[model samples]
Target chain A: MGMARAIEMAKEFGIGMVSIKHSNHFGMSAWLVQQAIDEGMMSLVFTNSSPALPVWGGRSKLMGVSPIACGAPAGDERPFILDMAPSIAARGKIDKAIRQGEKIPTDWALDSEGNMTDNPASALEGVMLPMGGPKGSALSIMMDVFSGVLSGSAYAGHVTNPYDPSKAADVGHFLVAIKPDLFMSLEDFKARMDYLYQRVVSCDKMGGVDRIYYPGEIEQIMRDERMKTGIPFTRGEIDALNEEAKLVGADTLNV
Target chain B: MGMARAIEMAKEFGIGMVSIKHSNHFGMSAWLVQQAIDEGMMSLVFTNSSPALPVWGGRSKLMGVSPIACGAPAGDERPFILDMAPSIAARGKIDKAIRQGEKIPTDWALDSEGNMTDNPASALEGVMLPMGGPKGSALSIMMDVFSGVLSGSAYAGHVTNPYDPSKAADVGHFLVAIKPDLFMSLEDFKARMDYLYQRVVSCDKMGGVDRIYYPGEIEQIMRDERMKTGIPFTRGEIDALNEEAKLVGADTLNV
Candidate 1:
């Protein structure tokens, strides 16, 4: 809803900013970036979630693994979309590992006792390790300040976990949309973006590497492939979705 | 100069943006952020420099270890300032290690052959390793896109090295200033920032850990101490400065 409004406002003005409070988790920020790109606009998407990572030098969780995402439009090329979390690995990966009974890498998380652990269950009981130590920790704090504090939402580790149903999530988001032609003609701006995309992907390859991908190129490729091949889902996943659909009296996926 | 104009424009309007091309290294980015803070404004500072780091999978140097910096003002408390390079360690640190005849950490850089090495000279010949691997590489690319490509300056590892006298540096910069009180009163924004600062510093410490610092707080502390006790410079440093001063017919610092 906020993104819809932001796009409308940005189309009228040169830029639009929307700060949302008391919201739920917005899945995959890149989708929002793509939405703005569809309108030929640049965007910045920021949000704060429940605490799952710790501040630097602290053992306990005090910050979210919230993502920092942004994008710019291009001409006849994939747009530049950057969506990254401060943590070395996403928390959902651990849950998946637990479901598959697989062991995680030691660097991904610390156990409840602060010891490095490979057990997925123990990793979930502990804290996700921030990437690049202090740099990642600082990035998480930056998100909280911009999204939570600025939006008057729960912050400073107070945001309720989505899994925890004791109270409201009270999440916060900071969204911005900027016209790509704000300072120059749309054609010129997109030409620059296309040139940048060419330079990045055409760089000399390293040994044993076949290709270099732009920030969001891998996802774009996967999306194109999926569009043709259709999504590959396991039987269990299909069953789970069907169950939810039945509960909501919605049409289930046809296998 | 761009910062001064940005401040003026932001003061008159609600926001300001300045894109500069064909410039020289502007030194520490924090100074620019501080300039905006002095004017009670929030700022984003970005620049592109000569190649010293590599893209994620590429062994060759193809990106600048450019710093991404931003800041916001606060009331009666230390403001938020973040200035960080994408590399594990700053390139200047390697030069300092060479001057002191010290070995850098093996993780700091790769040898010319793409192997990790502790020798500072060999590391200089090689590329500085990006922090958090792909995340840092993507960040450096983002800087180039915004500061170099968008500003119509040299990019894609084309910016001349500062120490290379073969050609002009032709650096580029992107600066933006936003009114912090755009959504609320200045006092409320500052109060929220103060609260964030307090929460971050007061986080529970891990085992054998000391006090945690807010972003840029360490530099503020160092600046305060150096203001009173003065900066400690080696005899060689002082002599080099005095020599340059003599050549320029300027007054030298007192010993």
Candidate 2:
């Protein structure tokens, strides 16, 4: 909903910045970027969540492993969509591993004792490791500054976890939409984007690598395949969704 | 010079964007961020240079290890300043290692044959690895898109190296200065920034770590020390500086 308003404002003005406070998680930042792309706009999407990673030198979690996401439209080619978390691996990946009774990579997280661990359950009790040490830690702090502090939401490890039902989560988001034709014609800007996409995908591959992909090309391909073949959902996940819908008096899953 | 104009325009219109084309390397992106901070403005500083890193899965260099920089001011605390290159280590570090006959870390770069190398000279002949694999690669690509492609400057591995001398550098920059008080009073914004600084520095320390620094704090400390004790310059560096000054008919070093 905020994205819709931001896109409308960008169409009216040359740019639009919407700082949302007291919000919940909006799944897949790429979808928000795609919303702006559908409107022929460039977008930056940032959000602050509960603490999941530690600062550079600290052990305990002090910052969210929030993703930094942005996108630009292209002409007759895949758009440039970048959505990345500051962590070495997404927290969801750890949760997925736990559900499948699998061990995660040792580099992904540290156990409660600050020792690197491969056990998914132990990893959850500990802290996610930042991608590039100080670089990733700083990026998460940047997200909190923009989304939490600036938006007057919880920050500095104060945001409540969704699983902890003691209080409101009070998440915050920073969204910006810019007109692609701000400094040049829309056509030229898109052509440049397409050219960039081509250059990125056509780069000489390393040994044992197949085709290279543009930033968001993999996601796009996955989405296309999911469209043709229905999205796979665990029976447990389907039941949970239907239960929530039933509680809200909304239509349950038809599948 | 671009920062000066950006600050002026931002003061007048609440925001300013200066996209520079066909320029040379501007040392230290943090200095540009500091310029805006000095004027009590928030800023984003981006630049594209000669390619030094490769795309995610590619063996050959295709992107510059351009820094992503930004900053905001604080009331009575150290401001928020982030300036980071996409590579694991700055290219200058490799050069310094070569000068000192020291081996770099294995993770810093790869040899000409794509094998990780500790020899600085071998790393120089090859490619600097991105910090977080695809995340860093995407960031460098983002820099090129904003600073080079959008500004009508050389991009996509076409930027000429400074030592090449075969053609103009044609470097590009994207600078944006924003009024920090756009959404609230200047006092409120600065206060928030100060709070953030305090929280970050006070994070719980991990074992073997005595201190945690906010982003750019180390640089700030170094700059302060350098101000008190004159900057150390090797005799060779002094000679090079003097030669350049003489060629330009500028003041030669007195010491």
Cα lDDT tens digits, model 2, A18-103, are: 78888877788999999999999888898998998888888888898789998888999999899999988778999999999999
Question: Stretches of candidate 1 above 4 Å error?
Answer: A4-13, A91-108, A115-124, A245-255, B9-13, B91-108, B115-124, B246-254
TM-score of the second chain, cand. 1 = 0.88
> What CAPRI class is candidate 1?
medium
| Reference-based TM-score of each model | 0.88, 0.88
**Poorest 10 consecutive residues of model 1 chain B by lDDT?**
B8-17
The best candidate by lDDT is 2
Candidate 2 Cα misplacement greater than 4 A, ranges: A91-107, A115-124, A238-255, B91-108, B115-124, B239-255
Ten residues in a row with the worst lDDT in model 1 chain A?
A: A200-209
Candidate lDDT (C-alpha), each: 0.85, 0.86
